[model samples]
Structures are given as structure tokens and as C-alpha cells.
Target chain A: MTATTPAPSAPVAAPEPPVLAAVDVTKHFAVRSAVGARSVVRAVEGATLDLHRGRVVALVGESGSGKTTLARLLAGFYTPTSGEIALEGVPVRQRRGRVERSYHKDVQLIFQDPFGSLNPLHRVRHNLERPLKLHHGVRGKAELDRRVRELLERVALTPAEQYADKFPHELSGGQRQRVVIARALAVEPKVLLGDEPISMLDVSIRLEMLNLLDRLRTEDGLALLYITHDIASARYLCDDVVVMYAGEMVEGGPKEQVIADPQHPYTRLLVESSPDPGRGARDRDALFDADADGLGEPPSLIDPPPGCRFHPRCPFAMDVCRTQAPPRADLGDGRWARCWLHAADRTITQENE
Target chain B: MVTQFVPDTDRPDAGTTSARRADGDVLHVTGLTVEYVTDGDPVRACADVTFTLRRGEILGVAGESGSGKSTLITALTRLQRPPAVTTGGSIVFYPRDGGPAIDLVTATPKALRALRWTSLSIVLQSAMDALNPVMRLGAQFADALRTHDRTLTKDAAWARAAELLATVGISGDRARSYPHELSGGMRQRASIALALACGPELVVMDEPTTAVDVVMQRQILAQVLRLRRTLGFAVVFVTHDLSLLLELADRIAIMYAGRIVELGTARELYDDPRHPYTRGLRDSFPPLHAPLTRLTGIPGTPPDLRRPPSGCPFHPRCPQRFAGCDTDLPELVTKGGHSVACRLHEPTGRPDPVPDPASGPASGPASARTEGGAS
Candidate 1:
């Protein structure tokens, strides 16, 4: 017998373009120390990208690349020092919104470690039920329990009977992640913000968790912002990719376009640097590190690189590149690259590699 | 014919094969059983796992968490403590002098210490954590040598530490540096030097390169290969990165639910993996170079070690699981040269009867996807 299930998400009407958009967004953090009077950690310099409806968008970069800072700004956990952040066509209230708690239901975050994210004393049911009881106005133990179980099942922690009763320590890394997923899905949030979802997990089991998330985004139609240092995982999961360099969107586009035909030097360096099971014989280490230094001192954002913020590390940097800030070029087909090479000539795309 | 620096692979006359004769393996582990004693019931960390590490050869053990890989390493190193008891097994260390091989399992506490660092050592994952933040790099190296060899004076220990610094690719200046001062790559190098302080014959490294950046990891791998060339000691290299293991390891072993599921030379395991679990694992991650190719991740999660599946630990996820798999656990039988724990292969003969055509997407003739690792 054929079955027809009710459509999961709301009907597409006005269809708000991108739940969140960074219009030339730049978040500069002032690092005031005893030694330095005014030094800015350009944590996130002129970064711009948009998170659209029902797709996993990966913000990939190394440790000091400002990926986390961007996530914080998007979460409204950190107020951007500069650059504009728009949510649903309306500018983010210029400050960490006073209605953050209320807005949290729409945009929920899941941390890297499930053990660290969930409290030890509380059970899985506690973590899941709290979001439902608070966000959905579900009162009564029975209703909260039923909803929590449903949430667990949605993330594929089936039966929920066995898992809901367990504590954080009792579950495996993968299972704990599923619980975290269930908790994030509790409020029926439109957006899911995942920070390194499976780094600490067993390498073999990591794929299973990634597949689960993929199903959620496709089936439930949830907008996902995947933040990670591991580029390989990002390549596997994200539909579209954003490469962040010292807190700026150096390159962003559809996964195949960006990953296959990278324009920005930083994006090329990052993709080349990470070890992929697919990339053969090429000494990835020498390919990436032989040129750029590993997370070497990023130029101060308060006083960003004289012209382009990336000129300092750009291998193909020229006098014009150093003196003049290159405008971001959207090279048709959802592909946008911020580089002098792209702005100057399309055919001159290949790096000196 | 004298055996030189040979890999642990089955092939005789292989290019890298050393002229040195096999001295009955440097490290022999048989029926190793370790259990973490919970409040009442003990969790089987490693059960009936068996393997051998030959002299001047690298043996790679790979598995997801709770696969008993770390437990097996811990049992060998005398690191497994009270809660994690070595229920059974004999970890034998074959000395160079033809002296009776020492059983690490029943060795005296004092003997265990004497054997450690000097004869058997470990290069741990997170060299930052392994190194004391407060102590200087040289000081920590000296401490390890002095603690192990009381005969060596302070001056002699200092000189040896400096030499070790050079051996591990760390400069003399780095000796005075703290763990924080050295970069991730340098710190890991120092840790390898520390493990090599007493010129250990066997080194047990657990995820040594997992935490570091890709550049540092490559540097570390190259350094390990260089050191092994000069030092002539066996390494028990453990990690989850199969591709890296394939590149570095001479022989590879796959662990699953507290037992060894498959063991073979790198060429054999990567080229023609026999076990369905091993095959599924190798196919999971995306390769680095090829961007357009679609990656295929395994569908299901590994079984819990606490109460693993009835028979085969991988039965639930195994694509070609048979009826016997539900009732009985198969032995880790040897086929050709590779050792695998799957009933699908006939232990008595080479080819086994093919069952269920609709089992898996990749159940074609073997060696279909066994070419180059990178797409």
C-alpha cells in the first residue's frame, strides 16, 4: 500500500532568501593586552556568505581561520565588530539580540563533544524534553515524554525506550551525537548549527553519523551550517562549501565547483593540505605547506593587510594586490571567489603550482 | 641468504625485505584478553585477540573505538591498570641475545620497568599531553633515560638526550624548549625521541599523528620511517586512518568488537580485502586529490562492545553475512597469506560458494575497487 506523509516543512510561499546573510561581514576582535595598547585579532575579517533553505553549508578552515568566530556571530553569541548580518532580509538587531532565548528555537547549535554538551546528571530524556517543554509550550510529563521519544526516533535513535533512559556516559560517541541531534530537533528549528559533529568519533563510525545528518537535512528540509577544521568531512557532507581564511570568506560556491575548480589561493591551499582518501600520490603536505605557513600570524584585522586582507599570505600576491583591495567576484552559477585573480581575468585562474 | 630490513608481509624476496632471518618474531601475542572491570560486570576490552610483531617491521592495528586496539597496545606496554585487567595472553619480547623470550604478561613489576623504554616503549598520541608542560624538553628525555638506566651518569644522560634530539629531526636548540614552545610537529618528534631514548627494540605508538596538522603529520610519518630505518626496531602503529596506515605499515590488522577481524600485508589488505567489514571501512572516506568523485560512507554504526552482537561483531553491518554468522563466531583463519575472520571464505580451500546476489552493492569479483587509494 502506498502511503502519503504530510509535508515536513512549511509550504514555500514568500520563501525567505537565506535565513542568514553576511553582507561583506567583518568581525574584528580587539585583543587588548598588557604589552599592546591596541592590537586587533582579525578573528573574522570581511567575511560574506548566505545560509539558504534546507541545505548543509559547510564553513571550512583551519584552527585560526575564524570559522568558530563566524559561527559565534551567526549564533548571535558574539556581536560583529564590523560588517552587516541580515536574518530573513532584516538586519540582525545591530547587537546581541535581547530576544536571543526566543530566537534560539529557530536556530539551535549542537557542540562537538556529546559528553561535554550534555550534563551528566541529566538523562537523554531531560535534555530533549527541556527544549520541547520550553519552546513548544508542552506541559505535562506524558506529553513531554512522548515528544522527546519522537525527537529521538527522528534522529534514528529508534525505540527511544532503551536510549532515553541512559545517561551521557553510558552512550557511545555516535549514540550521544544522535541524542544531541534529537535535542537540537526538539524545538522544530529551521536551522541546525553543527560544530565539528564527528571529529572525536571513531573514524569508521564517523561516516555513519554523517549519513544520518545527511538524511535529516534532505528528509526534514533543515538549513544546516556545518563548521569544521577537517576539510575531508566537509567535502563529504556539505552541498555548498565556504572556505574561511583568518575570519574572511576567501572562497565559497557549490561543493563540486569550489572543490574541483578552486579560484581563491587560500581555498586551494586548504583543499590541498587536508589528506583525502581520494587524492592520490600527491604529497599533500608539501603541496600546501611548501608554500603557505601553517596558521602563521594572521594580519591584525584592526589594521588589516594594506590592501586585501589575504595579500600577506597569498603566494601569487602582486603590487596591485598589496595596494588595492580586490572586490569579490561572483563568477556565475552560485560560485563566488574573493581574489584579485578572479576580478582581473577568468582564464588566469590557475595558481603557480 | 641474510634477511635485511624486511616488511612483515608474507612474500619472500620482496624488494624491501631484509636479509635478516625471522627470529620467531620480536613481539608474540597469543589469545590476549583484557577486560575493564565495571561496578559488577567486566567490559571486554580485548578478547581472544592474537598477533605477532616481527623485528624491524611495522604492524598496523586499525579499528573504531571499543575495538580493543588500544587495549591490546596497553596490554603489551604494561600500561593497562587494575580496572582494565589483562585477563589472559602472553606478550613475549624476544631479546637479541637468543635469551629466553620474556613473557610480559607474567613479568615482575621490576622486570617490567627494566623492559620498558629500553626494550619496549610507546610514542603516544598528543605529544603535548605526553610531555610535562612545566619541564624542559631535554629534561624530560633525561628523566626517562636516568629512570630506566641507573648506570648512566647525569652527563652521559644529557649527551644521549642531545643525540636523541638529532635522531628525531629536532635541533639541539629545541632541547631547552618547553612542550608549548615547539610546534605540533616538533613536539611529536620529541615524543618519538623520548620513546627511543633507551633505544627500545619495540615501539607501541597509539594515534601518534591523529591530532597534528596535515603538514606536521606528513613530517612525522617521514621521520618515523627514517628512524625505523636506522634504529631497526618493530613498531605497533595504531590508528583509524586506513590510507595513512596503508602507506606506512608493512602489515595491517583490523580489529572489531574486542577482537582481531583481519590481518595481512598492506598490499593484500588494500588490494584484496577479504572481510566485508574491512571492505566497508576502506570505502568510507573521500580521497584528497579527486574532488569530483562521490564518497561512499558505510550505512550503519559499529556494535556496542558492552553487549556485542550474538556471533560476528560485524554481522549487523556485514553486507555478505551468512546463516552461520548468526549462530557461531568464525575463527580468524588464514587464506593465502592474509588472516580474516569471515565464514564466506572457505578456510580449507581458496574459493567459497557465492551466496545471496542482493547482499551488497560491492559484491562483485574481488579487486574491483582495489587499485590506487586516491580516486
Candidate 2:
């Protein structure tokens, strides 16, 4: 049965060229107050990342951290305020005709809420068929039906005949999400970006979805970007991690290194705040009072902190962190962190313990 | 020590069932059932649910979306409106400060109005929608305060309002700002402050942190814990995220298909889960420290309450299902410090042979230990 199934995504191979790459991208929205003075809401500040085939890189951050805006920039939904994006080494342009169509065909985005994303009135078959026809130009009644069934089967929605006739409301949450995934796969995109794809799902089924995404990366070689606030799932599924705070990338490295020994104070707080089942109640009490270690909210994006965006909430904030922005200090072995604490000359002082 | 559970033999009753309260229990719920009366068969949103809320202790209610967590909260607060009815069970709320216990299920509207904000209050989900969008944050507090106590002057009420906001880490001056002007985290903190304006002895929070980001959620939870410590009030925290409960709750109740499947301390539930359904839920999320392994999601969706499964509502999806599971209902029975409602722990109605003892307590292996307690 596995041999009979057709490949639904790009073929996997040794890492060579990146499927998607963004160079110092930025997105800003200008807002005018009631008095008419204008200011830019820096939703995303200069960020760089690459998505390679057969790899998953996660964009992890809290709300208002500009992760979503960055995802939109890569998906071609919005052109960057500054910087550029390339698809398979070719610069992506805001042009009409063949360029736009080809760019969209190679990239697909699966939204957070499956219930909201899928058309309520449309049947599963219609939702799957429409995307297939629009993207791949599949035609004729028999061929369309065959393609639709194949799409469902590829997503593990077996007995495609049974689910093809049901509407979005008729299926369960997990099943609905499967349908959404199948629709994204229908185009056979080289890259997939999921923005909190399983946040709306039940815990029991969420792991299954994450596993499915990992399987796609391993088997189909799709360059996947999983954007989420929950770090546990990011570590569980992704090969690399990028931690964002207030529209800035605070840390980026391999998942194991970053999670094991988070260098940035913000990254440490995130790890500390996340509820781990292995720990006991004393750890929880410590977590509750951990704010005493450093207590502040994310600064306003419109007027972020002058130096480090996270300095306002950082425990290890130094005088330099308040006056000058810290450079991305390379710790070698594909690891780096944005913090004054990692400065080359400064003696390492333990702030968290 | 393993305790064998004995199933309740009483015949099923379709109407309200009165329950005796446990001492020190702020709220005692027994056999609570709620149904949404739509055009078709009524949706049994909550069914035969039972639990106890202790004074000054944080009790966490964990469940999935359709598991009746929200409906159960509404039923407890006497906020269930038309199209939704509390079909059965009693909600006994013992007023703190040595006042008389009141049955909220049958409480008159006048009595409920007096009870709200003064003795008990609710912090609803979605802070954006919960606050009055057009009104200033202070006026909303004044409105809640004045509606409950007409004796307090407007100036005095406003003064108290500022104090409440301060308690939740919000500046008192921001009370003048409209709901839109405040950030999401600030608005949520203000809403919690308003809920505490009357110094309610018990606060019912329904997914109060669900919409916020993780960092904000952590801050809010920390503030709430600090406030609870200072004010000496019990809290009933409800959310679909069990991991949060494990971190915060003194006691945790796992609900499924509107039933209390398991009730125990956070340590007990996390380290030694009794019900198979509870085990499945605990295993659902990827543990940060545990070795990477494939998670096994429970098969099949929650059963339709209108025509719920003939026997155990979870039998269809339970991995340890036996011949008796499809026909006999299991009652929540307490042993040691925890309670479980699965046939695996029950001593009687042996329709399937028990598993080997080496499999551990989560499975069917059991022997000595005695006594029972209501869920």
C-alpha cells in the first residue's frame, strides 16, 4: 500500500541549496494616533533565516514578537519593508504573471485554526479539489476525483470516500486539521510554514500532528517552518530553533544546544516558565516567584527599548545592554546568542542561579 | 497499596440528586448534569459530574473543549441561561466566615445576585470580551461594586477599585484608560482585579490565560498565586491545558465527556495516574525531560451525550476495555489520596481476567486497601 501511494511533495536529497531564504527581512506598519502623529509599529525587525530541504526550523516567540509577520513575508503574502527573500536562490519579486504563481505553488501556509481556515459551506472534496485544480490544473471529473482521494490518503485520512463528502463541521478537530494538511499538500509545495498549527488542537492529538509534520520533512523533504509559542513542541519536532522577543531574534542555534543551555536571559525565562512534567511542586513554586529574578513585560513594539529589545525584562541586563545593542555573539558549532552577557571580554557572572 | 473499588448499586435517577457536603469543602458538586436544548436531541454537555472544592486551595479542572468544563463552570456559578439547563445534581456552596451553606442550583435570582461579587465571583475567558469595551476600566469596577452593595458611596467604590488594580500589578492610574488602550496582559490583570473587588472568598477562573502568550500567561498566573496567598481565597482554575494544572493546582480533576474520570493531587496524577483515560491524557503531550517517543493519541472522538455509549462513556476509546466495560458503568471511587472511575480498579463485576501484577497500578493489577470517598 505504501509503495502504491504517489509522492505528495518534493523529493528528498542531500542538503545543497536552500528551498527558501530571507535576508535581513523587516516588516513595519505605520499607524497615526488621534492627534495625527505617525509612528511605525515595528512588527518584524531585521531577521535572517534559511529553510533547507528535509529540515524543520522553528520560529518561537510570544505574541507581538513579529513571528507571524515574518512567516507572511516568506509566504509572499506581504513584501518586506526592507531586505529580500529568495526561492531556490532566485530573488522573489513583487511581480505579476508567472513569477507570483510559481512562488505560491512552491510555498504553502497552514493556519492555526483549521475550523476558521476551511470554508464552512464547502465539502471536504470541494476544498481539496479546488486547491488541486487551481494549483496543478488537474481537470476532468475522473482525474479530479482520483487526485482528491490520493490527497486524503496521503494525509492518512483513510477511506477517503467517507470523509470526502463531509463538511468542515462534520469532522472532528483532528480530522479537520488532517484535511487542512492534505489541502496544503495538494499543491506539492517545496516549503511548508505552520503558524501554531496544533495550538487549537487537543493535547492527545497534537503530538500526532507534530509527528505527521516531522514525517513530511523526513519523507517528502519539504522545508518546514513550525512557528509556535510553546517551546516543548518546537524542540520535539524541529532540527533548529530561532527565539524571538519584541520583534528581534534573541537566539538561534541547533535545537539541542539552544534548549539544553539557553544563553540569553529571555530564553532561560521561557524554558523556566514552561511547565515540565518531570519536575516537582517546589519547581512550580520557584517558577511562580521566578519573576522576582526579573520582572517586566515586553516593551511596546512602536517604541522598543533602545539597546536590547529584551533588556527591559532581562535579569542579566548590564549598563551596556541599556545603552548599546548587543551583537550576535558566536559560540561556535552553529550556536549564537544576542546578549551582552556573552560579550567576549566580560567575566561570566551567574545571574539565574 | 492497591484498593479495590466497588461500583454504586443504586438505580439511575433522572432528576436532581441531593448530596451531603464534606466538612471544609467550599463547594460540593454531585451528579451534576447539564444539557443544551437545541432543535435536535439535547446535547448532554455535562453528565454525572462530581468534585469538591476546598477552602483556600487551588483546584484545577482539566478537560478537552467538549468535555463540559465550561458548562460545568456555568452550572456552578448559576449562570446557565435558556437553551441550556442544569438537568440534575446539586451545587452546595458553603459561604466562608461561618455563614450558612447555599444550594446554587435552586438559589433564587435575588439570592444569587446578592451572592455574586460579594461571596463568589468569576473571571471569564477572553479578557477582551469580558470587559466593557465602551466603559473605562474604573467604571466597570464601580458598576460591579455598586450593583452588589448600594451602601458604598461612588467615591469610596472608586478608591477600592484602584486598590484592586494595584493588587494585580496594574497601575491605579490606568483605571482611567478604556479597555482598548490597555495591552492584552494589562486588560486581563484588570479583569482579575475587578473579579476580586468585592473580596470574594472563592474565585472561579475559566481559562483566564488561554488567549495570552506564554510569558504573559506566566506573569498573570504568578500574580494570581500571589494574590491568592495574600487574600486567603480558594480558586477553581479551569483550562484545557493539564500541564499548567500540574504546575499550579493543589488538587486536579480530570474530566471527560462531562464526567469526573480522575481526581487527585498534582503529584499523584502526574506520577501515578489511575484511569486509562487519565494515563492517555498524561502521555498526550511530549515531556521535556522524558526521552523522545511517539505519543499515542486516544482513538475516536468524545461520545455524543444524547446517545452516550451504553456503558462506560470512554469504553469505545479506552485501550484497556474488557467485556464488562461495554455494559457496566463505573462509579468514581477513592482510594489512598486519589479517585478513579475505571473498571480496572473495581473489585466486582469481573467479566475479564485481570492483567499480570508486573504491569503496575495504571493497569488492572490490584489487591488490598479499603474505604471509599465520593469524587
Instruction: Give each prediction's DockQ, rounded to 2 decimals.
Output: 0.27, 0.38
Q: Assess every candidate by TM-score.
A: 0.82, 0.91
Best by lDDT: 2
lDDT of 1 by residue, B121-198 (tens): 998998888999999988898899889888988878878888888876667777888898886777888899899888
Q: Output the lDDT of residue B119, model 2.
A: 85
Docking class of 1: acceptable
Alpha-carbon runs more than 4 Å astray in model 2: A1-15, A281-283, A290-294, A346-353, B1-22, B356-375
lDDT of 2 by residue, A270-314 (tens): 887787765644766576773542366788999988888887777
CA displacement after TM-score superposition, residue B71 of candidate 2 (Å): 0.4
Native contacts conserved, per model:
0.31, 0.56
Question: How far out, in Å, is residue B10 in model 2?
Answer: 12
Report the error of model 2 at residue A2, Å: 39
Shift in Å, residue B276, candidate 1: 2.1
Residue pairs of candidate 2 with colliding backbone atoms: none
The B-chain TM-score of model 1 reads 0.86
